[model samples]
Target: MPAPRMSTEQEIEALDEVCQRLAGFEDAISLEWLDGYLTAIVASPRRIERDEWLAKMGQGVFARAYADPADAEQAIKVIDSRFEVLANQLDPELILDDADVLRLAPLMIELSDDDKKQLVADGHIKEDELHLLEQTGEVWAIGFMDATHDFPNDWPDADLETEEGQLFDECMLRVVSLTMEPAELKEVFDELYDGEELTREELIHEALYAAQDMRLYWLDHAPKPPQRRVGELPGRNDPCPCGSGKKFKKCHGAQMQ
Candidate 1:
């Protein structure tokens, strides 16, 4: 049987423990960033292996490692559970529960009062600039963009020639805009939003809509297996009928013998 779904409170507690454990590592990503990164992996047109994405978790050349091996294993379990939840949410055939929709909501960067004051005092941002910072989803967008950046070959430029492709391109641009520096953001916003800044509510809505569009686009466009005649077995070297991109012999076919 499949694993039981985690309760909302349980999921929160597990993620909190993960964040606390990784807190001491300067290069480790925040929980919000991890959420976005995993969302991108789920929405990817091609399946990214768990180990491959896990290795890319750190900020620079170094990979994030837990001091205790047990902690690492436990953290991976939590992260993998979240990954499965995201993948299920994007499955086109599945009817989402209310809780699933709630889980789909993007995690945004929330600043403590002290963090706000520190930013203001350092002149990194004006006091007023901190308003609605929690709803902007900037860090989440950065993490999403990072995944796309790392796999440029996997995420090719959208075909502007078709309406659906054009819409997909627009959605991608909207998400990428959130990751821009002030000057870059202004340039993109001017073109995409008629030079008006998006409010926090608008940003949140746009990000959610973009993610939905991504799910739909991939469902329609991802590669499919060839049809087979009734009772005809798959060739040993053919792509697995399960759509895993592995040869038949290495996938489900291995179970037959």
Candidate 2:
């Protein structure tokens, strides 16, 4: 039997616990970043293997051995669950419902007063500018960019020639712009938004829309999984469905026998 599905609140609580446990590690990504990473994977043009993507997560933190094996296992389980949830939300075959749409939304990071104070101390922003910045979605954007960088070949500059491709490019740029410094972001805003300043909410809205568009684009453009007859197995000489170059008889079919 399949495992029980977790509610949105339950998932949030689970992710929060994992993040809290890893608080000492500066490089450990938060729930927001993980959400963006999983979103990119769901919308990717090619299917990424579970092991490969999990290793790529948090710069391979999830794949590393921990002092407490149970802690590592628990964290991995939460990450896996989140990935599964995202995959289901973006499944092309399903009609998007209200609940699915809500679940598909990105987990944006909101900066608290303490966080803003730290940013000022760290020289990331001015104390006066703290009031201007709300939830910037910077961390989530970085996570999305990381996933794209992993599979650079999948998103090519040549795509910019098409209308849909251009839109995709704009969307990606909008989200990535959140990662820029304030001065840099101002320049981008002038170029992309006709010198009109955007609020943090507007920027985050763009990021959310970009993610939705990416899912739609990949649903239409990505290679479809090969159709198979029900209850039929691959022929001994056929290419393995697992995507291995080896023939069936030389791969998983060999194990069956």
Candidate 3:
């Protein structure tokens, strides 16, 4: 038999009892299971009525408690802290693609720029694509990509501790300026010289050299151009300085010799 429909207040009180009773277990049953239970508890599914309590309270309450999940770790502590013996759970994978993003608590959320970047990188639903029964987060009844929302004005929204991936403006500008300016300046040098010097290939070689980390590392340590060898020079017929221990005439110096 269908459970008798009660007034909104009665249904909410009944929902609390249901939650408390289920919190009996040391480990959490699936939240979907809870949703299914409460869904069948108060009223018929076909009715237009919504349960004010369960809509706001279900899995969302649990997800929010462990928002930055890395911190509050143990299942025992989580359930014991808030609900006492009512409920305890761990690692709710509420964010679909990037589990780093914590769950969505509300029935709706407007996507932020960070959210869009994460959606694209993680290969979940995109903003332009369609045919959603409703856009949803892994937890709660979140709807994404909306322009305006009807929920609480001050609800906390966002994935805590998701690293800000892109560089700041000043850092980005410096990277572009340092890497590109030398290449551009080479063109100017070529024009001024009437293309007589610094061929395109030569400019590419110079640009690549300038971009090299190894070249930069040695730049300050490079020996100054020598007027002549400061140390002794091997005679043409002497053993090679290259450690082949053969005569200089027979090794690396052989071409000159």
Q: Who wins the lDDT comparison?
A: 2
Residue 232's lDDT within candidate 1 is 76
TM-score of each: 0.66, 0.66, 0.17
lDDT of each: 0.71, 0.72, 0.33
For candidate 3, give the lDDT.
Answer: 0.33
Candidate 1 on 1-257: residue-level lDDT in tens? 23334326688679767766565574446777777787888888878898787776555322355656777788778877778777766554442223134225655666768988998999989877776464457778777878887767667788899998888888898787776666787876787788998765676667766876787688677644457768777998998889999999999989986
The sequence of per-residue lDDT tens digits that candidate 2 reaches over residues 157-199 is 5267789778778778787877777788898789879989888
**Candidate 2's error at 88, in angstroms?**
3.6
Q: Model 1: clashing residue pairs? A: none
RMSD of 3: 28.5
- Model 2 ranges off by over 4 Å: 1-7, 20-28, 65-71, 93-103, 112-135, 223-257
**Model 1 accuracy (lDDT, Cα):** 0.71
lDDT, model 1, position 163: 93
Model 3, 188-211: lDDT tens digits are 456433544554334433322221
- Model 3 segments more than 4 A misplaced: 1-73, 84-110, 130-257
